[model samples]
Target: MAQNKNALIRYKTIDKCLQNRYRKWTLENLIEACSEALYEYEGRDVNVSKRSIQLDIQMMRSDKLGYNAPIVVYGKKYYRYDDESYSITNIPLTQNDMDILSETVQMLKQFKDFSLFSELIGIIQRLEDKVYTEKNHRDSIIHLDKNEDLKGLEHLDVLYQAILKKLCLRIHYQSFKAKSPSYITLHPYILKEFNNRWFVVGRKKQKRTNTHLGIGQNFKHSVEP
Candidate 1:
């Protein structure tokens, strides 16, 4: 559901490996396996290499994917989840991977200040957990852009929920020129980002004004509807 490149590759590897029990695959085999799987799923062949698989393993170990299964090697044979209290498949994630993922989770905490929808966060977390890795790969990894405004995430989320539900909202809008916060009821129809700032396009209920909120409204007025 989430269109993360690293996460998708990891998931495909794990799924492909799990689908075949008697089959033992090296990194090379896993790459081919994933290539075939992608061809079947995407209706096109996507080129894959050992480096990509290695990165997938790194990402999974980074714990962003939340899987911790040990693929064991016996002489020439390779198998995952041989014997443990939790099957390798059931391991959830390796400690290292969990640490990385935990850091990711922590980074997301910057949005905790804003209004958020429970369902949206749940969906994001679920998708985040599906990432995995293969034999030759190091682990799965994801790096959020650091120079981005993480705080605006909550505002985006609130706007998204309002738009999805078609619900009007009472928002405390701050205008830089006004020097004070003003309350307005808005029929939030869309959320847009321009120049890295988010805007809520809606109709103001009080003034019955059709407004496009982009660079921040300086003058404050109330919306009735």
Candidate 2:
């Protein structure tokens, strides 16, 4: 099934909120939590409706999305997961989930334009590897060039989003030629992969530099916008 990105975010936020058994979560609390989470991740304030969060909780309680979360109401107003160990992240993929993932991987592979899909290539490959491992019960057959110990990969998703949203980012980076790490404000434009390595192409936010920097995917990097 095709997923709604915002809905997924709301579900995750609700799940996280409910996981904190120490806090007594009400409907208003959940709505606030979801709104705050969306603002933090997307860098914008989104008005999360009560009905939307209600539906999110309903869906999480059902088997439709394979969550079947053990969410229960207590004291007639507060919500919490009955099973403390229950978490959506911990749920194993069902056979149907694997089938859908396999189809998605196959469909994505048909697109040959790597430039447009550079950042997604790693994520798709990881999904492909998981599907392959589950099916064959062994290691992946189709090996892609990836460094298991590669640093700064965690910044990929946030940077990609920032580029799409045209958000300026404050980055701390260290180049091999530099004596120490330097800090710069950047307007990220593209994520490029070449020669089995990834790079983020962007211009300096403060100075109008004609020559934009290509930040290589490596050690010691931080992004904040």
lDDT of 2 by residue, 1-225 (tens): 223877898898888888888889999999998888888877988888989988898899999988999889999999999999899977766698899999998898676366656556567756866776676676433333454433345565566557656787777777777788777777776665545555677778666663234445533344564
After superposition, the stretches of candidate 2 with alpha carbons farther than 4 Å from their true spots are 1-4, 41-44, 103-120, 132-225
Instruction: Work out the TM-score per prediction.
Output: 0.33, 0.51
lDDT of 2: 0.73
Computed on alpha carbons, the lDDT of every model, listed in order, comes to 0.55, 0.73
**Candidate 2, clashing residue pairs?**
none
- Across residues 85-187, which tens digit of lDDT does each residue of candidate 1 receive? 4332545455576667657655665565556643244334332433322222433221222323323444554565556556777777775556677777788
Best by lDDT: 2
Which 10-residue window of candidate 1 scores lowest in summed lDDT?
A: 134-143
Best candidate (score: TM-score): 2
